[model samples]
Target: MTRYKIGVVGCGFFGSSLARELAAHPRFELAMLCDRDFERAKDVAAEFSATPTDDHDAVAADPELALVVVATPNHAHAEPAIAALEHGKAVFVEKPLAVELVDAQNMIASADASGSPLMVGHIMRMMPGVRRLADLLASGELGEVAAIETSRSRWIDTDGADPQWWKLDKSRTGGELTHEIHELDLMCWLGGEVTAVSSIATADDGFRNTVVSFAGGAIGRHTISTRSHTSSWELTVDAAEGSVHADFHTGRVSRLRGGRVEESWPIFDVDAENQSLIDSASRTQKYNSGNGGSSLWMQAAIRHEIDEMAAVLDGKADSGSPLTYARERALVVAEQVRLGGGEPAALSGSAK
Candidate 1:
């Protein structure tokens, strides 16, 4: 097996977790861990026997690095990713592509100019349950997808949150729309390209919703609420024949017809699925809390995504360009601005 040398920028929760997983992968050699917080980088690097550096530029410039994984904060993704891509390294960007459309486009353009393999980290697509759901849709068992409704809602207490908490900043996280973009991306992947985004609404309590129309004639409603008393992460596809639902909180996917479950399966292996169910029963949030890592199935999904990137770098066919995901995301962002009383024309450089 040809091993790839990997450098990860942002040694925070997601970056550290990904670095740990990559260290365990047979086809990956953890080469570098970079973060502005040098101590954090050193801690993660020590675990993997990898070099630690605070300089992101050093990772991109390192001749020994073969792949650069940008797991930085939502808005900070572009610079490191583009730098790595320009240096001719295969780059994997943790999703939303970028907080801003221009940055996202620039990242893609850099990859194109450098002939580097660029992939977005949309781990939801690799989830076993989601994969099965995709398979069912593709096989025509679920029929043509007519609509997709997704929600990831949890209470985010900002009363005493640290001022440095990046997620609290709409500019950095792009609110829930880009921050919790897994649902939107999954909706587009299953329902097809976004043709129109009809409405986008937000509330003072951190509730956001967007109504989108797909080119394939499917309608989608994506929602995210940090004000909810109940926490949930789920997506349901209503198709011509039946419906399929994936409950991330429980790590289960079900196929239904005539208002009954026709088939059901774990989103991951049995142990992981059971763990998710147990965790969900006691959890207050659907996503990672503080510096904690993601759930078991989510970690597994990341591993699958790494393998996909490896395959793509090995000259195999890619699932799709990261640009496609970024473009779809930009459409939703544009709509949000238009509906929020901001000029749609601002989208050209709005996020910049």
Candidate 2:
């Protein structure tokens, strides 16, 4: 198998983790690491046995780099992504895609113009439990999904945070856009497209909550709060026949149907290898969190993205464009929250 050359921008937690994972994949060549903090970049570069530079343009200009992973802070996604695309590199960008709707549009438009594969990191769809739930819904095993409820909350101690915090800056991180867009995308992926949204966001208390109506006549409610005492991530789907629950943190799936309940944990299975790769890819692509079972599964997805891009470069694979659509829906939800008054306007796509 031919290895794809990769450049990584940003040396933060998520970026460094991805760089390390990519470096371990024989199918990928870690070509360069870029960050404004030169020292940080050098450290991550050393881990991957790659060059480190403070210059974004140098990474973008590398002829050997076929893919660039943009894991910078929320505000900085667009420029490097656009630059990489213009320099003929496919890109995998960390989520919210961009902090602003206009920037997200620009990135999408640039990807369209460049004819390069673009993928956003909406990792929930990649989780094994979530994927199993989605598969159940698709198979009619859940007997028609009626609604989806998702919750994510974590305590925030300002005293423990660095002075240069980016998450608190609404303009940069887009708060819920950064934190809960994963749920929004997963809801869309599991239920259907969101037709309209009505939301109430609390800026003073570090909380965001929204109710969304999907085109498939399903309703979704999301709660994202940073003031909670403990972090909780959960997704539940209630249907006519029964309900499915996914604990994102533990990768557990529980199903209740016809007065009987069943539960399962994601296990390593060679027979389910391809599906496992898709599930793992979705997780790393979105969450950047290591897989609970084996890091190899998550690494496989990262390598898969690189391989897919290499395939696109070699005219052997179709561009994975669903990710762009997912990015668009995430932006719509962000805009709804930003509007913050009266009912949200009708979403672009049909619900059913």
Candidate 3:
């Protein structure tokens, strides 16, 4: 068995976590850690026994590295990812792809030009529970998807985040909608391509509600908030045959007809999932600060995506293309940011 050599740019919370996972996996060798902050890179590199550097260009130019994981701040994603892609290195960028439309387009274009695989990290879609729901919809077990909705809301513990925290900068994070794009991307993936969307958002854009029209004639409602006292992450789908719901808060997905559940599946392992939630609540009832200590369920999702990336490298599975699902999600977010407080707007491209 040959291990693909990989390196991670941006040695922050998510990037370091990814490095740790890749190091532990047998199919990949974590070779380098890069960050603008040398100390951050050094610390993470020490843990993983990988070289540490502050130069992304060096990482991109290294011939030995087959993959470059871009876990930089949302606004900074394009530069490193585009560099790696242009160098013919497989690149995996964390979600939201990019905060702006132009940057996203540039990243996609570079990937196409270089013929290197580019994958965005949308871990929600990789979860076993979400996969089960997607399978049901694809098989028409729930009939045609008439409507799909997702709600993700939780309070942050800060009035305003630390000045150094990029998430507090709307220009960088694209507010809550783009920052919490997992649900937005999930709706499009599980439902279908969006034709148009109408949204309402708060002044600060910390809360947003959007209605999406799908090319398949299905509709979707997405609601996200960062100001809720109670925290929940759930999705519900309505179809001609019946309805289904998934509650990540409780790690359960159920199929229903006539208001009764016909089948139920654990989102992950039931005991571990429940324990993770308990531990999470005991630590902080508020939203995760991305300072580490993510739930076991989330860790599992990351591992699953890592496996997918490896499979793509081994030619066993197709790369998770940014041109399709990721672009679709980014388009919806762009429209949400544009027409968020105005009249309904059609998606920029032709309907699916």
Candidate 4:
């Protein structure tokens, strides 16, 4: 039984969570933890008896590390990822792939030339309910998708450390449109290729609405904002057969027929503890167990991806997430260039 040595770069919020997940992974062990913040890196590294280093080059340069998870901030994704791929290590990059078009393409090219597997972490694709929704869409139970729409809105106090400020610069996070590229990838998977998209963004607030045209003639409309007082995440897909609406937080699903709600899936009841996949079709969800109250649902999605990556390494399966996630990132960058002249929300009382 051979185990893959996994190194995690950038042990911040998501990075630390991924470190914990990788440490517990059966086939992969957390070999190293890296962060410019030395103390934080040491804290997470202790969990798995992994060594901690501040040197990004050391993590990439290690041939013993079979996989490196690039959980760095958005702007930081490209370098460590490309370096690891170049060193012949498989790479797992946290979502929004990269903040810039050229960086995204270069990451993909580096992986291609190195023959190391590249996977983008789109947490939504890991959700049980979302995967079920995708299943129904592809099952033809929904017939041809006529339209697909989604909304993601959240409000932060912005008074404390103000992490939103990390994302305030489009260079660091890629404005709201680019930030929602995961949803866009889901849109492409559920419907088809998005042949064209026209979007309008509000002032510096990060509110955006985009009208999407699909190659299959199906349409998509998206409204995404990080400025709202009320938080939400909902998605609905309409098709010739029926429609399915999902509440991302609860994993509640609803079936619609004749433009009226036919039934609401008791996903919460089925997954009483708010765990497990309500729909049985989810092979990914069915096998994975709990994380001991660490984080539910979305965290489960991350573990699912980790396991899939292990399978890819074992030659039991092909790559996990599609390369199109990388391509769509390029497309988002192009669209943002056309729709731009917008700036990220300014950090309060900071130097202008």
Which candidate's lDDT is highest? Answer: 3
Please report the candidate that would top TM-score against the real structure: 3
Model 3 RMSD in Å is: 2.9
| lDDT tens digits, residue span 151-202, model 4 | 7766533344344556546667775566556666566456655456667777
Q: List the residue pairs that clash in candidate 1.
A: none
lDDT of 2 by residue, 159-272 (tens): 544445665566667765454577767766676666777777665746767788777789888887767666667788899989887765554567877656766655223335
Where does candidate 2 clash, by residue pair? Answer: 121-285, 121-286, 122-286, 123-286, 126-282, 215-351, 215-352, 216-351
Q: Between candidates 3 and 4, which one is better according to lDDT?
A: 3
For model 4, the stretches where C-alpha displacement exceeds 4 angstroms are: 162-165, 180-182, 260-294, 319-334, 337-352
lDDT of 3 by residue, 133-224 (tens): 78788787677888888988877666444766777677888777787788878887776556677787788766778887877899888888
Worst 10 residues of 4 by lDDT: 343-352
TM-score, structure 3 vs. true: 0.90
Q: TM-score of every model? A: 0.87, 0.80, 0.90, 0.81
Question: What shift in Å separates residue 277 of candidate 1 from its native position after superposition?
Answer: 5.3
Better of 1 and 3 by lDDT: 3
lDDT of 4: 0.69
RMSD of each: 3.8, 5.7, 2.9, 8.3
lDDT for model 2 comes to 0.70
Q: Which regions of candidate 2 fall more than 4 Å away from where they truly are?
A: 140-143, 267-325, 341-352
CA lDDT of every candidate? 0.75, 0.70, 0.77, 0.69
Clashes of 1: 0
Q: What is the lDDT of residue 342 in candidate 3?
A: 34
Clashes of 2: 8
